[model samples]
Target: MQVLATAGHAAHGKSSLVRALTGMEPKEPGPALTGTAWTRLPSGRRVAFVDVPGDPRSVPAVLAGLAPAPAVLLAVAADEGWMPQSREHLEAAVALGVRSGVLAITRADVADPGIALRQARERLAGTPLAAAEAVAVSTVTGTGTAELAAALDRLTGRLPVPDPDAPVRLWVDHAFTAGRQSVVSGTLGAGTVRVDDELVLMPAGTRVRVRTIGCAGEPRDEVGGVSRVVLTLRDAGPVAPGMALVAPGRWSPTTSVDVRTRFGEASGRLARRMTLHIGAAAVRVGLRPLGPDTARLTLNARLALHVGDTGVLRDPDRRAIAGVSVLDVRPPTLVRRGAGAARARELASWPDRPDGALVLRRHGVLRRAELTGMGCAVPPDAVPLNGDWVADPAHWETLRDRLAAETARHAAERPGAPGLPLETVRLRLGLPARELVAALARPPLRIEGGDQLAGGQPEPEADGLQ
Candidate 1:
């Protein structure tokens, strides 16, 4: 299923449009500032609205939280022309690979509609957005609501679709309390999620019971197909936005990844090391160019990114300039000098043993925390030294014993640290991908205070990170 996101400058009539489109108010209570609102609209239509803060810092969270390949709605006020924040949202959307969208020129009665349209065209010129159509709308007058909804229905076909029989997975973009239980809201990416379906929260993989599923504010038994859903989870714990409530036996967090990213006109040359933001997770990656169409990079920090996940590249200031989609995911060792045999051999021995520094030269499925919990300890190193105590045959037997002991000890003692990134461990071990992963399944040791891991924490609140 596709996760559609609504983003524009503040007060572009997005909240009203969302209500008209889905008939649900994601903007809860009191007066609405519309700061990154997400909801599962009525009729199994899942829409996540990032009501941007109009503040410059909020742009990163809006762009980063966006579901990959989801439909985008660039709402512009007809009377307001192209405001500063509006342009920022537009560029961020374009960077995320949003091609098909319906431009809603709101406040038509209050302002000149044509002027806004012209400004939007100018801002989006030379991009795919220039070719798409627009629908004029007014929340007060109730004008053009039907036309915009129809256009959205047509655009839904382009968003990603998951197998209906596949396990359910959703990025919890919004979480709040309705009454007695914790509720999570986001676009359903795939499969059918129904009332009382048992679910698992990833990294921790804790069991959560489902009490009800609300689609577009109405209680329902089931929902799918680009629909928004608010699920009352039994074991909500500290679950928040960016957390994936996935069907059992379906979710895999990546440690190494092969991604394809496109730089924007304003983007400078992507350097060797940078940070990547996806959903609610962020990590600094060591970037390596493979070709014009491909890239081989390592996450300096850690995350369980997946194949087909959307990620945005940002500068140190946290400003996003480009977005990427994962094409492949493997072990942290895959961040090899080349995607070759030698790299594989070196990374294979990594997991179960201690190391000085681990680097995910590429992004892959294994979660960094789980990987690290496998008895691997990392020494202080700003970069993934790719150091391995087991690399030498003499040290192999000793390291092997340590790996076994660590995995059993940690699995029983700590269970798992959802906060630890698997990438951090892989890079720290500097072991071959195969070895590092095997230990991840049943880690070799327990991890205490993180002395060396970076980018291991998955900050769910994008606003807080800002």
Candidate 2:
């Protein structure tokens, strides 16, 4: 199955194109902005259409539709050529990293599509969709619909296969009651959801069980990525839009994140307060500039955000938008005077792509699971210490030196004492576990009584020193 979101201005024939391609009427019985729709293509491959609103006031809805989709179906009317909403929709898609999609020139029977086609190509230039195939279609006359479907088929074929074994992070776009059960639907970007599988509702951390799964309007035991999914959940006491269902203990809900702008500048030009739109959730945020292009956003509410996730920051007062890519979800505290500038320099050195080794190097040491939870792909060559801890090679060496120094200092200060206690050493070094301290103990410095860290030899008695 494949999912492609519709991006264009309202009344620009986006819904008409969807209706022609799916051969199905609008299920919501109102404007396309009301809800999402799904159907099977002629090739037996199911496709879901997330009809998004093009109005400026509905920018959040537009982002929600584009956030989870891997591709898009961009529409432009032949009579209107190019409109303001068309550019906004295209920018939104680009912001969300949507690459592969087909361009549909609607209302071709009423006006020549040549002008609109050229205009779209000019606007799409230098974007991810620069090479997208265009088809002229008139839903009124049923002309070019077949070609449009064929183009979509080709687009689906080119979409990269998603990892089915990835952790589940289903952003709920719609939630409603059915009979006596609660149902939530969204596009599953990755991972698989199965019946009876336990998932945690993020931010609130409430656990819920999947009673049933529906895909392409059919009941299924399990569903995989790139497919629209509806799950009937049990114990999901007040599920709502903007909430996400995720694998338990695999995600970290954070209220602050560091991001780099991909669209607008993030310097003093941006407002101090803005709205962040990611997946199906929108939250008020406080923006603090770390650099000309980088900033820290403090969200009003906690969100299960990951490194490399793309989102939009909208300043409603200024009617401005900026495309942002997350750099760090758990950034360090900047309580000092020059800390923000120092952090900006550190972020400038980071690669655009997420790297686990970079994270390990920055933090010196971290649990392996914690790195994975941050959406970092741990490098195969990462140095693993005792237990679940992994450390940077250079950082581990530094820790050994620090331990020896601390032990020597303790002996000099308290000559009669056996040595520094292992627990104390762990605390002094800020190590998360005591096993790490034991692992750092070398030949000369050893754990003598299985509890106390001693130097090579015991210190002389106080009277012997006299």
Candidate 3:
């Protein structure tokens, strides 16, 4: 289920296009809808559509929710032609790295046939929609409605298929009540949203039971994958847009971001303090400039940011610097933007050794994946069967030295032993079994299994002792 979104300047008829395409009447008043409301196609293959209000004031909220690879729909009123906000909206969509979309030329009826079409083409010049994507339609005449549907179908075909088995991550884009029901509207980025399914709201760590599900203006048996869905929770309140309900252990907190930030008129060479809008949460951060293209930032608030979490960036102070994204949050500090960023992070003195393994030494245990990643697979004899590594070459050598010392101390105390016993060596090393195993697996350190233990050499088996 590929994610697609409807984006455009104010009064461009994005909401009407959504209603026309997906059959859902999304919050329209007096022939216009001014807020973002995401909806999904009921088709088995879920297609999420975020219908964002054209109002520039709500750009922060709308941009915050324009994530997980959304297809931008630029609505242009043929008669009104292209306006300043149109370029801004298109720029925001372009900044998001989703250049492909439908250039919906609305009010085709009112638009003069020859002049309006030529101007519309010029307005969307150099865009994917410049040729095939633009669909001129008048809701009243419905002249090009079928053509629009066909174009969407063709585009949706290129999207990745949604999986039912993956973790359920419903990014709530809109939360509102219709009639007596309190429903949460969100896009299914991937995985199924089912009835009675237990989903957790991220970072908040609150759980809710799904009481109902819907897609494309109608009830559906299953919903998933880049889809717009409304899930009625058993016990929930004010679910809010940009909230994610995902599988356990799939997300984590991040305090840093790697991105190439540019200065638009709205963003005047960002200063230190700004708010980051990343995947369902807004975090304040202190920017540490590493170079012109890159910067290191520390989040002012704690968020469950994972290795590859994405989001939008906005300066709360400036009205215009309100849209940015395309970043890897809480990552291992690779630079996509900025000069000397790598050099700066390196100068910050990061260890080359596996820090996770070292931390496990202090903490006692680790998940299997962590151990495997560090090359620490121990045997029944507590001898390391794999090698440990770190980013800093110095730390790797230091770790090996520590392991050798621990093994030697154990051998000296025990006297005439080929290998150190597991418990004495671990206790003497002041490390958990996992960490000890990881350290022993370092290239310079070696552990062998014998009657006692083996580190330096094989104990000479005497006939009498045998």
TM-scores for the candidates: 0.62, 0.93, 0.68
lDDT of each: 0.59, 0.84, 0.57
* Clashing residue pairs found in predicted model 2: none
TM-score for predicted model 3 compared with the true structure: 0.68
lDDT of 1: 0.59
Model 3 segments more than 4 A misplaced: 1-3, 22-24, 28-48, 113-132, 176-182, 218-221, 236-238, 255-268, 319-398, 405-466
Candidate 3: residue 117 lDDT (0-100) = 57
TM-score of model 1 vs. true structure: 0.62
Ranking by lDDT: 2, 1, 3
Best by lDDT: 2
**Sorted by TM-score, highest first, which candidate order results?**
2, 3, 1
Worst 10 residues of 2 by lDDT: 25-34
Angstrom error of the Cα, residue 10, model 3: value is 1.2
lDDT of 3 at 261: 52
Query: Candidate 3, residues 10-108: lDDT per residue as tens digits?
Result: 887777887777666555212223333333333444454666667777766566545555576677787787777676666666555465666678888
